[model samples]
Target: MLGDMILRAFRLTVRVSAVVQSSCQCPALHSCRALHSSPVLWAGHNKWSKVKDIKIPKDAARARMIAKYTMMIRIAVREGGANPEFNVALAQLLEQCRNKNLPKATIEGAIKGAKSKQGAQYLYEASGPGGCMLLIEVLTDNNTRSHQEIKRIMVKHGGALCEGARRNFDRKGVVAASRDGISSEKALELAIEAGAEDVQETEDEEEKPILQFICDITSMKAVRSALESLGVHTLSAGLEFVSHTPSLLNHAQLETASTLLEALNDCPDVVRVWDNIHAQNSQGN
Candidate 1:
């Protein structure tokens, strides 16, 4: 989507901005003006703000996902077996951990603890602004702590937790993949043939056009099986939100929002941050 392209452009511009700000010892005023006046720099900053206003909730969401996965791994071992070959969820989590390059010892320890039956399970939730929705995957022995943290983050970020957010999320599972050399139509066909509910494009300046497919939760396994049956190379595959309306931001506000989102994202508990921050054309917010 154009939003993804905007994000990539924003990131690149930010890197360039950082270089400019760092190398210019000539005058502080001159360097600041360059940052504010540069077209690319301004566009990037604006895009970032839109993302922050809508996409990112706070750090707590990530922290929650990590905790939930940890608990799930523990539960998987205690109930089925430590060896992933016999435990599907454990195997999937293991695959995810491996894909993310998580420490071997960490994965092993989670399994071992699960085998000991010393782990507790936690539920995940989503929250958002008035019309925004957030999906939060969390893990915690103390539900109160998790809930409070999530609530705090939402309030701090001009959003809140509510039962309503659940309505915005499609329980149907979705997977994201990329087709660098292929056209968007081709990617859509592959996904549809695999029984995908919907297919959307991804925007990446340097990479191939990315596509995402939505399928029934039960059909997700089938979709993956079919994709594998076709031998397609997917850049990423996971569940994500489909925002109703993407948000927008001004240039100055965008910069501030980007910082807020990054700060919140840096929190360990946060797992995934999604929002509709880019849905307009403008020079400022």
Candidate 2:
């Protein structure tokens, strides 16, 4: 009986040792197997995951941009007229819509809706970071709801609503044209003849030069027509609120302001956001 008992004790010790050894070796074994096996597949999956993360936001942004442009087109038609040729704003907006690759059917529907006066236009003003002024344009069927939603978004982003914010900015008609086919001198001459108040040339994201013509709101149609008659095709032409007193923001302040503007713009009813922050590049109309 004593010999059997000692044998049983030895077996128990051996079993415990085996368990400890397995516990220690399991992690290393898994690591080795993972290293020797299909790391390429894992890497490919990780890469695809990263691409998906990047693309989903971009696709959503594109969709939002399309929707905003559609709303702008509709508003333009409603305020001016449905006929693009007769309504300069609508004509310019349609050009921009085409440039953005908005669907033809969607554009037509917006025009029809606008002709029926289906929505109300709104302008919201706010004070942003770095003492910048913000002008948010919105169009919706419900003014009260849009106003509340916009105010909420602004306040959430450390901004507050302001009244009569247009007093801080100058309303002007802006026309953006590419410098692809014409010389700067010729573009300037045409713009001046068209009653443009200012002519500035700047490069786009592609480093291609773009010529911008600023004119009185009353002269937008004339300026556009004159440029077109001279064989100068404009990229965009619309009304803009030019800051009377532009504010310069430091890097940190600029970042904060940009974030606030983006948040405001993401609101579905927001058509365009105008700010007083000085920027090297001008936004599309």
Candidate 3:
């Protein structure tokens, strides 16, 4: 009887050990399968996801740039005439569009749209973060809709539409040029000769060097012509509202202000957005 009981006990221990071993093996198999199957799939998925994320913003920015140029073309032709030869503004705008790789057909379509009274120009002003001001230019067929949309965006982005915000800015001609091949001294001399009020050198988001020439609003054409005659390529030459007293913001305030500006700029009707927020490191009130 004692021998039989001991044998039964040994059998029960074996059964329990087998059950535990099987449970452990099941998890090991599952883990092996997961590890082997997921690395390649996850890596590929992650790579594609990153590409998609980058491409989306780039494509959207390109679209916005095209749309802004299109609107400017339409406004130029409408205010003047479709004949580029007779309309200097339209001619300049056409050249600008071409520089941006805007399609010929798109330019022509914008001109045609202008003739049909498809849209009107509007200027909006709002107070943004850190006591900075914004000047938003828009072209839209519906004034009420544009106003409501712009107001909503401003309010949502920690800004509010304010009256007479333009008073804080000076309307002037701004000419932006790349400093790729031009020396600072040469740029300053040229700007002074062109009757520019100020010549400032700055870097773009990519840290590319840029030179800006500020002049009286009425002197843009002359300044632009002077630069072109000297074989200096201008990136952009147009009227802009520059802040007289720029507001300095901290990093957090700058982020919020930048977000608001980008949101305003992404609107289809918004052509350009100007702000009085000083550079990140600048000291201002």
Candidate 4:
């Protein structure tokens, strides 16, 4: 159903706008001052947007792997047990690492490092225009480095660190799982039975159906355990800020917003970036 619809939609769009323009017009950059100052541009089709969109999924998957490894180390230490034989979340995260083809050496290093780590860490926070809350997750040994990097990026993109950005997002346990063989009806049923407060279909264009579940932080372990018991494979199970309502961005602003998201996400300290940005756009503060 989706593939046919996508093909039809693509056909309609391609038919309407067929004019191909090069990103760089001037062939001689040395003569043109504007061209000389500006970044290099590739000639021909404006298919970079499509390519960028495709790249996002791959980037997200890589970022998730990094976060997963970081989390595994933290979990191992917090549990006061380096062995996954006892700690379940650590065990689960390790399983995820294996599935992603992450190196066993990386996994072992995380476990070992966590055992030697000590003390509490700084948690950075930020909010975009219109209260689009962002939680900057980091595990760096240097707080200053993480802060400076995130602060620079956020300010550059019309966003700033908030005094209490954490308050904007409900302190709930958020989990993402793919629909392997289970039907949507059955998944929702299992989720609710497992104490999920709400389930939302994620905005993903992939083979598997993505579902987001919300639950109180305290009940998170139980919820995960319940779902796992039912044999439902969860892609990711972690905490997140669930938006009450997404802030809609205008078509003009959306381009910049996406760019900002990309820049912010590229930073190593930035583990997760959440926005309330919705589909509707209204002007003013």
**Could you say which candidate leads in TM-score?**
3
Error of 3 at 137 (Å): 1.1
Clash pairs for candidate 3: none
| Candidate 1 RMSD to the correct structure | 18.1
In candidate 2, stretches whose alpha carbon ends up further than 4 angstroms from where it belongs are 1-40, 115-117, 179-195, 199-211, 221-233, 279-285
The list of candidate 4 runs beyond 4 A from truth reads 1-64, 71-80, 85-89, 115-120, 181-190, 203-209, 221-231, 244-246, 252-254, 281-285
Best by lDDT: 3
Write down the lDDT of every candidate, Cα atoms only.
0.62, 0.82, 0.83, 0.68
lDDT of 3 by residue, 1-285 (tens): 999999999999999999889878788877876899988999999998987998777777777778888888888887888998988778877877765677888888888888776778988988998888888899988999999999999889899999888988998888887787788899889998878888878764334688889999888878878887877778777676777888878888889998998889878889888887876565442
Instruction: Itemize residue pairs with steric clashes in candidate 4.
Output: 246-276, 247-276, 247-278
lDDT assessment of candidate 2:
0.82
Return the candidate ranking by lDDT, descending.
Answer: 3, 2, 4, 1
Q: Lowest summed lDDT over 10 consecutive residues: which window, candidate 4?
A: 18-27
Report residue 136 deviation for candidate 4 (angstroms): 0.8
The C-alpha TM-scores of every prediction are: 0.56, 0.71, 0.75, 0.62
Model 1 lDDT tens row, 172-202? 5666565657677877788878888877776
Assess candidate 3 and give its TM-score to the true structure: 0.75
RMSD of 4: 16.8
TM accuracy, model 4: 0.62
